[model samples]
Target: MTERTPFRARVHAPGAELDVQAYDFESPELIGGDDRARLDAALEAWGRQVGMLITAKTRAVVDVATAPSRIQSFGAFIASAEGPVLWATASSAGGRILYRIPLEEARYWAARMIGAAGDAAGDGAPLTSVERALARQVLTEQLAELQHATGGMFAEPVLEAFGTEPPSSVDRDAQAVVAVIGTLRRNDRRQLAAAIDAELVLQRLGAVAPHQDAAQVRTRIGGHLALAPVEIALRFDPTRVGPDTVLDLAAGDLIPLAHLADRPLVVTLDGEPVLHAAVGGNGERLACVVVSNGDLV
Candidate 1:
């Protein structure tokens, strides 16, 4: 037993004391790597198709490069561009895309597309009504290509609206959305940046999963059936015999297939004629050389 000093306790007044608790907090789960990869591939395909369509429509060599996407705020992202943009939306995916083109480039593209002379002044002013209409039409074409490229993952894309200021708030965190940046190059000289709001990309990725599975099954079946063998019969001469004559024919009697010795030969698979050929030798072996290919008559 040892003597101890006097003990002292400190207390705080009501509403003046602070209580703190420390614990582990879990982070929100992001889109999985595999899911992200799938989405990326689809996006690249969509971008490629868009480039092809633009090139075909404008007669300009267009190239599109889809960069890796990230999760971020959509509103903040749009505001960062700091210029007028063309905004459009696609169904099913339920997302909008913003396209910003340099005035010179836009005028060039529009002029080339509609076969008109571009404004030479290159003034960075608002697009005239005619220019805006043409831009919307071109953008709508791009949307259609995207719809086809995505294979129903997204429905038709329509030009919803466009302005210097994008939709300030579409969703609570529309500010926090997935962003994919694509660069469209014209004639290897000018480039336009297109920002894709991928808020609905996850939905499109999930929608295509079932279709991908079914396509795999079809591919496997087609592959296996391609190797399946079929019978090919050679015809030399023809001899027609009725049912009663065939029953009475002796074993030594001949039943021919072709009428003439020099006639072109026919090959059949499952009683359906498939090819027309002539008899030929391959390395001292008799082979039916196919001279013409045709479907069954």
Candidate 2:
């Protein structure tokens, strides 16, 4: 110790140690791989339609691409959205979901619509009244494409509202299948993301396959109907009679009907006409020979 002349033996500490991060929390919710893959396929089809719509509307060739999707809470998705974005809210059978595109993208559409310089877009400025009008029109049309794209995923999804600011109606905690859509950007292509309800899609896919054969559906319906019994009525045109004629009805009284002889009569089920038939005999039992058949009303 005497040899250490006025020197301090100090252990230099590396400040306060941060608590070691460990796998201490439950994993976030996510759709399974197979389901996610199926969803992606459906979304890819939708992107193709959108591209066609834009190309048709603008008379310009624009390709649309779908990026690999992400699963996260709507809150996270909304918060992470950078810069000004126009959000179009759509109410579906699942729930109210959001569709978002950068305001710059909206301006791009507006520019093309108004026959302005399409190359000069995204000035990082708010849309004027006229620009907003044009943006709204294109977005409304886009939502129609969304309807066709999702099929029955959304039922009559009327565009409720749209603006640069996020509406308070969105559920913050709801997990979403956020899709990144890339189309006609000022810089060439935009990767705008929109949140779709994961629960809705999973539940729908779990219930029904994306494709169903029409013939198979008809056969299924026919099989079900064959086992069901229904009361059927044969009718010709009604004979108009006074109330006195009804009250004075007698046994074996003849009343002429409007039906012509040898012509097919209307066969009805539950008061709606569904078939044409002619009176006939089947092994001594009276029967109606079906001449034509149709769907029940």
Candidate 3:
């Protein structure tokens, strides 16, 4: 071995074995796919019902989208009948849930209800005395529908407070928001969006204690799951084919299934056979009635 050459020691601190900046472990809770789907359907119903109650001609279609957790600072603002960035906090089993909407959209709806030619530009100004009365009535009706739709998931959600002003103090990084994109149409087009903070929506599903409300919640969840939405796939008989055969198939080629055309189809949920149903039609629509229960596994 030759004599080793001298080396300069590292004057600065050595690089860290683990990159502290890159190490991130915080996983803020979020609703799962099933719950998200359920909420989407419920909110769509809520939007449709609001449209029917507000005006027969004006329709509002809302699409629900998931929003990631974020921090928000509340600031004072004015309220409008249609929407002036309204905020409402409701107490739930997990904690408090916050709902928000833009005032312009709310005003647009109010205008339609009153059959008035409202201004195109709604600045979210405080509604006039008459407008405020109409707006509050509509708001209460919509809120009641929302409470009914979400009754199965959330606790008895009573409207705790409502104002144009944002909360004075809130946790810096606490809110988890869900977005609702709405389209209002009455000859002219208008778009609006609202958000709801559902921090405890998913958590409360499984949080069971001996408390009165908790006990009721648990009982309700057990009964509600049967009504939960599920995909009922209609599967024909399987015909196993080799990879080479699959690769050589073309559009016109027919791969005959193992069963006859009249055979009952296998209805599956989550990839497990749940029922056997015979395929048929019911006046311009495809329909199926259960023939028997399939072996579930």
Candidate 4:
């Protein structure tokens, strides 16, 4: 037996934990070219409505504009989004959406809500109790009304809560998309970002049943064609005979056809073979049941 050296244990460092919030976004994008284009068109209309609503409610003069949409996870959206925001959770039948407006703009809106002009917590401080309550009331009602009036993506949005940060229950990994609504007032530009439910947006974009459209077209054309009356004729393979053979044929003369007796005959529509059928008798009338396209023997 050989002598062994003293054994020693070595410790290994644990693998670095994955920080999802800080994770780089190398993943495939959610929306595609056509969806983006459709969203853009919808946003254009939405902007007009939003502009009118803002002036009506806030009494603030701001130019509302639409920004192109973005696709990302909730975590990524929160991570990359800049500035402190006032967040509200809007729930409806369709689903819930997280809306965030920069504190600066929120202050502006809050100020106007309580009959003030750009004077509600403009120093990056929290909104006053009265200002916050009024903000919540206006936000929930205005957003809900916008959905109903537009008859578009959202339904009746009931605000669940308003806070300095998003609710803790919101899944960081949940798929989400962002839409920015820009406003300009008194030379101030601000963007309000909404981390909307990805599925809701996708549902709106693809609400049209494009896959069934072709079937509908086929059914429509078939229905119209079925209404038209056409002369149909049963045909058999023609016999290839010389002109002299035809001339020799006389009364009571038997002319053998080239078609095989066992084989099915062709049913023609407008001189085109649309179906194949076997020779049969139905209630003493010559008839046939349609057969397979391949060798209807």
Candidate 5:
């Protein structure tokens, strides 16, 4: 009976938790890694989905020497239904990096998913299950779009591990988690390696034009010429015209074009003479001999 002290119970209100916010996730192990290409592709895809363009140089994983570790922040652009929203975040993935997104970025993405489901439904009403399925589909599609937008700059080997298709019932939270995990998969490592090698080859290949037969260039040039405009103009020399005497000036008098016989006509373009030819009769109409070598002007 020595322990007779009363024990008091502690109760917390619904909202009594401290408001300590967790910083954005980062991985120090990712720094100076051999799989930069896959990570880069993944980042690129993520950025694109958020309508953002980010650079690895501006971000940091962690300051290994500092207490509590710090990550650098960078700028980002987020797209919303209203327009682009701008914000910044400090990331701890590689170097000092920042992430900025629109205030409604998440909502905008959700809406896009809903819209995609609607499109897939045609005229039928979409059920909750159908909507969830569509949302997952849209998420995958949008992820691809992001990959393209970044030009494969952000690589993630993890995506290849899960294959292309995501789960059907993924919600927003699950989607985010899966996306990050997919970015970290081992298969992505090989993909990134291939991409790096390909990029290097392309860089070298772009340095010089491949040697082609002369006929090819000539053919190409001729095809280009065929698509260009051709202009033909006929010019007359004043000396070929007879003077309009007083007899020829009489009322209702018809003057014949007799001086247009056997004289060479000129063809010019932009005031530069290009050809000389004789004016001749073609049936009841007049024609010209297009001299190939003479100057027209």
Candidate 6:
């Protein structure tokens, strides 16, 4: 037996210990490329909507990033339908603050900024809270306008979620960690849609040329168009007739008009009377021409 080297009892010293602490792992489901693409498109739409709501000088930007392990700081304007409720934030990286701006606040701030600018040029007084509120109402009304213009391309649930919150101020940074956690949990599919829409609208508005008048630009772009004849026919409100009468009418029965003989049949564009023309017989064809304005009688 080769003199077996006396097995040196090599007592290995224990390596330094690692500081093990509780690690909060964020959800790593990973927003997919398709999801991200959808988000981008929705955000663009939102920015455009906001831009149309506010004056040209005002601007908004939206970004998404990984939440930091430690608290960071951020700042942003908290707006509502009423006006700039406040500017608040929590800490964030790269000097940016995390924020949740209510739709009301956005509407308010946009209106206020525009109104102030108008006043500066002697066009009108600075927008009061009431005026801001009115602007918000207009914004709500224009939701339909956006949907129609976009041909329902954007989802409605998303826009609704973003605009659901009323105007109010908040200190997102005061409870920075909590805010981040809460945002992750509370921002569901609907909220995400809303956020994207808001961001897109704002971005588009901000990109408009500075020389162009915001109000005039909005007027030109936002003007309601005459729906195609087929579209108009499809949307015709039959509510004018009693439900029972409507149900009882046979295929051959002619629906009587509320108008009288010699009265010009009124043609409306988007439910608004745009033209008045008298009914005439051109051989076997019925014709019409512009006439005096009056209620259907």
lDDT values for all models: 0.59, 0.72, 0.54, 0.70, 0.34, 0.35
Off by over 4 Å in 2: 1-29, 184-187, 207-297
Collision count for each candidate, in order: 5, 0, 7, 0, 25, 30
C-alpha lDDT of residue 236 in model 2: 86
Q: RMSD to the native, candidate 3?
A: 23.1
The best-first sequence of candidates by TM-score reads 2, 4, 1, 3, 5, 6
Which should have the higher lDDT, number 2 or number 5?
Answer: 2
TM-score of each: 0.51, 0.56, 0.45, 0.56, 0.27, 0.27
User: What's the C-alpha lDDT at position 179 in model 5?
Assistant: 20
Q: Which candidate ranks first by TM-score, i.e. highest?
A: 2
- Alpha-carbon error at 228 in model 3, in Å? 37
| Best model number under lDDT | 2
| lDDT for model 6 | 0.35
130: Cα error in model 6, Å: 44
Return the lDDT, model 6, position 262.
50
lDDT minimum window of 10 residues, candidate 5? 72-81
RMSD of each: 29.4, 29.5, 23.1, 24.3, 31.0, 31.2
Model 1 spans > 4 angstroms off:
1-29, 89-104, 117-121, 175-199, 207-297
Ranking by lDDT: 2, 4, 1, 3, 6, 5
Error of 1 at 239 (Å): 99
lDDT of 1 by residue, 71-109 (tens): 555555555564445444433346765555545555666
Badly placed stretches (over 4 Å) of model 5 are 1-47, 50-215, 238-262, 269-271, 283-285, 295-297
Clash pairs, candidate 1, are 73-175, 74-175, 237-257, 237-258, 238-258
lDDT of 2 by residue, 1-297 (tens): 445223122222336454434432222435557766777776777677777877766667877789877777788888888878898887767566688888877786777777876676466888999989988887777667666786655454567888988878888888777878788633486666768776766666673345778999997887765545445677886678889988988999988776678668888775888788888887966778888765532
- Poorest lDDT segment (10 consecutive residues) of candidate 6: 226-235
The Cα error of candidate 1 at residue 79, in Å, is 1.8
Q: Itemize residue pairs with steric clashes in candidate 3.
A: 82-106, 82-107, 83-103, 83-106, 83-107, 84-103, 85-103
Across residues 15-51, which tens digit of lDDT does each residue of candidate 6 receive?
6443444434332222335544443454345445534
